[model samples]
Target: HLVLILCMFLYINSVLLFTLRSKSVFCETSRYILLYNLLFADTVYLISSSLLYLLAAFRIKLTFYMCSVVILPPVLVYSVSPLTLTVMSLERFVAICYPLRHAVIITIRSTGVAITLVWLSSSLNIIIRVLMLLCSNTEFSFDLQMKDFCSEEALFRVPMYYYFVTAYSGIVFLSAGVTIICSYIGVTLVARSASTNKASARKASQTLLLHLFQLGLILISTFHSNIITAAATIMERSHVLRLHSLSFIFLNILPRCLSTFIYGFRDQTIRPFLIQHLCCQLK
Candidate 1:
């Protein structure tokens, strides 16, 4: 929890420094808003899910009350994050390809509506899962002999809950994968055509890099899902532990560490702004 808190603090400070120091050269309000939303989503994950893990690592038992309090935010944030990325990709595509109608189409009101929809959709996943858990008569009993975090056998003992979890996982993965693929193809096509102009090409390249970074993150998440499924299927302790650790490092820790490098430092505008911000802070 402390590590995650420190990382989050560093992230916020870096972003603040960059935003404050940067000259108002580009008035890309939509992009700025998207970045802000991404940061907020990550913050939610850091506070909720990451904290839970940290507490567990320190042999701290989170009270049922605390678990209840911490659970929803991370689940909702993670659920909505991919959707937000998809929306941002679409917004970028429209801005790049249809510059004339970009202003009319991607208005502040429309952006707000889109963000709300993403949040709503993401929240529904957790809500439905929680509802299923609540309605089920089956109680979760931890088996000390099992050597697993939670037993799938115990969960599947309730057939309805099993089906609900399966459906939820499928929907989330499929939705994220489809959006990512569509965005990649759309962005690639637009980028190819706009390659003639150096400035346009540069912007296109940056956008592609951003998309790639996001896609990598999603792919890591998908792999984590597969690892979990495999663990559940085989019930092997070693495999479960290994996969769980890898998933945590890649999905949680690495993404937070790499986000600034991929999103901010790689961009021409953001890099200078970050440097200026750091220098100013030092002075």
Candidate 2:
């Protein structure tokens, strides 16, 4: 929860800084927009999941108001963000592959439309999941024996809910992976063709490295999801519950922490920006 709060605070601060200094400092409007959206999504996701985990950790009884106000929206937004990212990857692919027509093809209007569709699709899943949870008579309670900060038994008890969650999550995961693979391949081929120019090769290598890092983060998150699904499946069987629970904590929670580190510390541009921001804050 502390980490989540810190992440949320940093993200909000970054947005404010960006908004104030964007015109003077940030040259790439599109890149700034993408980073802003991603940070927003990460903030939402962390907050929502953190709330649930905190509640479970201290055995706090969740009020109806808390569930609706603090929990639902972030979870829904987080789920939707991956789909948005997949769309963004596709957009990037088109921009690089068809630089001649990129401006005409991916205007602000078109990107807005794509974002809307991704949100709508994600919203529908959230609606379905929530409705299913509400209509069902299952009680929501944490399993005492399990070490998971959040309750898997409470969730998987609703098989229908898990089914939809697994399917939609898998779809986003697979789609993102496939699109990244294709995009990487195309970009690499183009880079090879332009290798005659040293500057072009250098730029291409930098871009490729950035994408590789992004793809690595996505893959880590994807693996976390698979671990979760597997854990949820075996949650009822007492024998393997401990092992699954341990895996979940290390796999899911660790990845979220690692994501910011990898993106902020590893990226050439983000690293310097973050360092400068920290220095300013310290001073």
Candidate 3:
């Protein structure tokens, strides 16, 4: 509960520090819009986890519907973060690689549409999964054991559930991975070709690298169950459960926090704001 509360505080702090003001970074660009959306999704994910954690902590009976409500929105919204990152990378690629055509290729209206579609697709994905679960009783089962606030592993049991999660995660990994890698490569090549804009190119590459790194971390967190299971025997059961729960909290919240710091807080606007704030404090 404390951790979740702290996560919320950190996220809100980061957003207020960088994302809220008009002079703030990413505020004007499609990149800002996408970053905000990603942050919002992460916020939702954190809230859901925190809600479940508190409920379980209080011995609240997490019914099938409650579990689904807590589980589904986060699962669905969290996907938007990676998808947004990929799009941000591609947007940067276009800005760097094809500067002249970027205005025409990426516009506010178009990016807005793309974001809407991303949300719609994710919603549809979750809706279909629920419908499928509802239809095929044998393939899907809501396995919630809330003594210790269950993980995604406890959400689905047997048959198509296994296949669905595997395929779903695999597709997200492959697509987002490919999109980031290809976009970064494009940015790198263009940077190499443009001697005058070498600094900007290098900076863009570094930003993409951070995004990739965060994506990798998020993916690892998604497999928190496997990690805990693998190490369960080496540690006490209570220790493992505590660590697993911590991972679930951090994994959902930390990546976005880092992303905000790396991409959002490092903006031109925020630096001056930080400087002024520090000066005021010192005074």
User: Which candidate achieves the best TM-score against the true structure?
Assistant: 3
- Enumerate residue pairs that collide in model 1: none
lDDT of 1 at 134: 58
Best by lDDT: 3
lDDT of 3: 0.72
Expressed as tens digits, the lDDT of each residue in 1-283 for candidate 1 is 5465557556654564357335554334666566667666766675565666665456554433345556667667775666766777778667766778989999878888888888888778777766665566445432222232222232223557667656766776567667656755665676667343446645655665665576567546645656677787887777776777667767765554454555566666667667666566564
User: lDDT at 99 for candidate 2?
Assistant: 74
Give me the displacement of residue 163 in model 1, in angstroms: 3.5
Q: Please provide TM-scores, in order, for all candidate models, with all chains considered together.
A: 0.73, 0.68, 0.83
Off by over 4 Å in 3: 1-14, 21-28, 57-59, 138-151, 273-283
Q: Give stretches of model 2 more than 4 Å off.
A: 1-21, 24-28, 138-157, 195-250, 253-273, 281-283
Off by over 4 Å in 1: 1-28, 138-159, 194-198, 209-213, 222-246, 256-258, 278-280
Evaluate residue 233 in candidate 3 and report its C-alpha lDDT on the 0 to 100 scale.
Answer: 75
lDDT of 2 by residue, 58-154 (tens): 7765434344555566556755555655665666666666777877887767767776787788788778777776677455532223233334334
How far off is residue 215 in model 2, in Å?
5.9
Kindly provide the TM-score of model 2 when superposed on the true structure, using C-alpha atoms.
0.68
By lDDT rank, best first, the candidates go 3, 1, 2
Better of 1 and 2 by lDDT: 1
